[model samples]
Target: MIKGNLAGRMGRMGRMAGDSGPERVLVAASFANRVGNGLFNAASALYFTLVVGLPAAQVGAALTVAGVIGLFAGVPGGHLADRRGARPVMMAALAVQAVSMAALVLVESWAALTVVATVDQIAAGAGGAAWGALVVRVGGERPAVFRAKLRTFVNLGVVLGTVGAGLALAADTRGAYVVLILGNAASFALCAVLLLLLPRYPVLEAPPRRRRWPVVADRPFLAFTALYGAMGLQYPVVSLLLPIWISGHTEAPRWTVAALFAVNSLFCVLMQTGIGSRIESLHDGGLAFRTAGLLFLVSCPMMALAAYTPVWAAAGLVLAAVFVHSLGEVWESSAAFALGFGLAPDHAQGQYQGVFGLGFSAGQALAPAILTTVVLGLGATGWLLLAVLFAALGAVGPSLARWGARTRPQPAVAAEATG
Candidate 1:
């Protein structure tokens, strides 16, 4: 049943981007890139701690500081893409990433590690913004749907990479870890080369008299970003808080954490495109966000209640909660793609996406400390409060979206009339 469903969905995605050479190239590059990322993510911490001999606390602190610094890279990166063209900027970012990843091999101390990690994170942020702009050029009429398809391939690639990483983990040797790191570096180089095959997109010149940072001055979009960031709290809930919550608070086996992650990944691979297809407009995006919030509300309490259940029941409840949460994740992701792409002007997609990325990055960075305090320290009540937060964000999403839409300059309308 799963195979049939996935195959059918894959078929639909293929037809959606039929005969688009750039789209195919982009998907292949993204898949390759993600596979490398998965390998690095799985083994990098162990490599740093065990092989490089950095203290775990120091490693965490360095990464946190690096992430904070990297947050500032997006806007400049996007602006550069707008000025110099996204394709070349994206290739440049990938090249930097390849160099940074390769340089990781030379890091023997905390300071070296921090420097390398910070550089890699900045490149990633910039590359992401440029990639968003490139997608806008290549994604034909429905970029969100195309991005959803890309995400499906991304999940598949990550799964494949993680499976490969398992071998290195089992080996538990410096040689194996080095191989993983080098493999990731090679993938970045490969991605850069592949991007060269893409057609050059013309750089969009900003209008005379436009503000230097229009997105910063856009109040309604910023409000939307805030709510989107709030919705993104689900990420750390799954990645950080849930595992701790399951292990320390609930009677469910420790392995349930892995099981839940597997469920979420599988759901994304099979269902993302389908859900994304439904979110074609800002109104649809708003509705999707609301639905996601409500689903999270349902799942959060179920997760909390699992702490009080019997062993078998606790496991069952947690599994169900994760399933529900995965549904919400799919909806939230699809909605975000729609709103993020739809609300932005065609010429400013890079900068707009860069600005939009800030919210998610901020949520990811803050979620660890905030969730640990609220969900872990405060317990079930904290979960309820979190649920209320998501619900409120969802409740207001439509109004926020409408306001953004109303405020946007109707360049498309003028172009349409002139054409």
Candidate 2:
């Protein structure tokens, strides 16, 4: 009796492990990629300003161009993915990224860096669509769980990557830039290898009739796309604006701000699954938007308080704000994924993802300038404006969601059968 119980327990554990599927492999790949990406992110600004000696404004301008390139590239990338298989498209994206990173390490001029950055951004967008679509293909019916699993994996990647980057930077921040570039290249190679192991699934190829722009004229789809674009604006505020704000206020060292950001990443890694589980039942788009709105509305005001507060107090407030922001991140991400994968017409899935990604690209392109103008030009006043903007935009999500809910139910998604 005892032996049987032990065997049963072991079998169940093994089954649970296997059920995670290709998710584990993807997670490992993402971890390596993020480490290299994180290293770049941690040091890139310094590299440009200190080593490359480019003006901050110029760097910003180049990023804006990169965003534009990424936006334009998304549709073509998706089309290519649909025409080719996701696996092939993904491998191509990785190869582009790897080559670009290697060139970046050797390049001496800002012009070359700008070109590489733009091309890399385009590759990123293409790769992103293929990856997300592939996940949907592999996930079968449990997409939410699958997405949650992937989110956790990505977050775990962020944590490890950030830690590794931090340590590398600490050793010799200036010398580490080359290593950062190399790290990113390594990730691409790793991802390419792992992708080969993923089960073969039907690829979305271009339609028989071509020679035209992809159409995304559906009203509900447009609305969803707009909401996603608006929400994407929040990322720059967090990444670019918030750090500057933290530096100006409070005597806390720079590392403190990095630590706070790290906390956000850590929570995303640990709590995503638990949080995702509870919200799985609330599939209504309107509810998801409302939830996101509440988080932004409640958290944005906390930013203004950072200037007046003590170090510990400021840290606490920032931590709370980050946590709230992450909740919205999870909900918005899940909602966006569901809408992109599930809501689009069966024949138009690739087009839907492409066009919607265009919206994201638009937001990404515009954010650096608009956000910088508001936050840097106006100071704390701009942050308040951002807060209001987030709240208002979040409010807009529900109306869009309601419209979607009222529309005819989207047809069930058919999983591609693996060969």
Top TM-score hit: 1
lDDT, model 2: 0.69
Query: Against the hidden reference, what TM-scores do the models get?
Result: 0.94, 0.84
Model 1 lowest lDDT segment of ten = 410-419
lDDT values, one for every candidate? 0.87, 0.69
Off by over 4 Å in 1: 1-19, 411-419
Q: Residue by residue across 275-379, what tens digits does model 2's lDDT show?
A: 554443223445666677667766666766777788878877877787787777776666666555555543345556778888887887778788768666886
Off by over 4 Å in 2: 1-20, 52-59, 173-175, 204-215, 249-255, 277-282, 310-312, 375-385, 405-410, 413-419
lDDT of 1 by residue, 146-170 (tens): 8888888899889889989999999
What pairs collide in candidate 2?
82-204, 82-205, 83-205
What does the lDDT read for residue 244 in candidate 1? 90
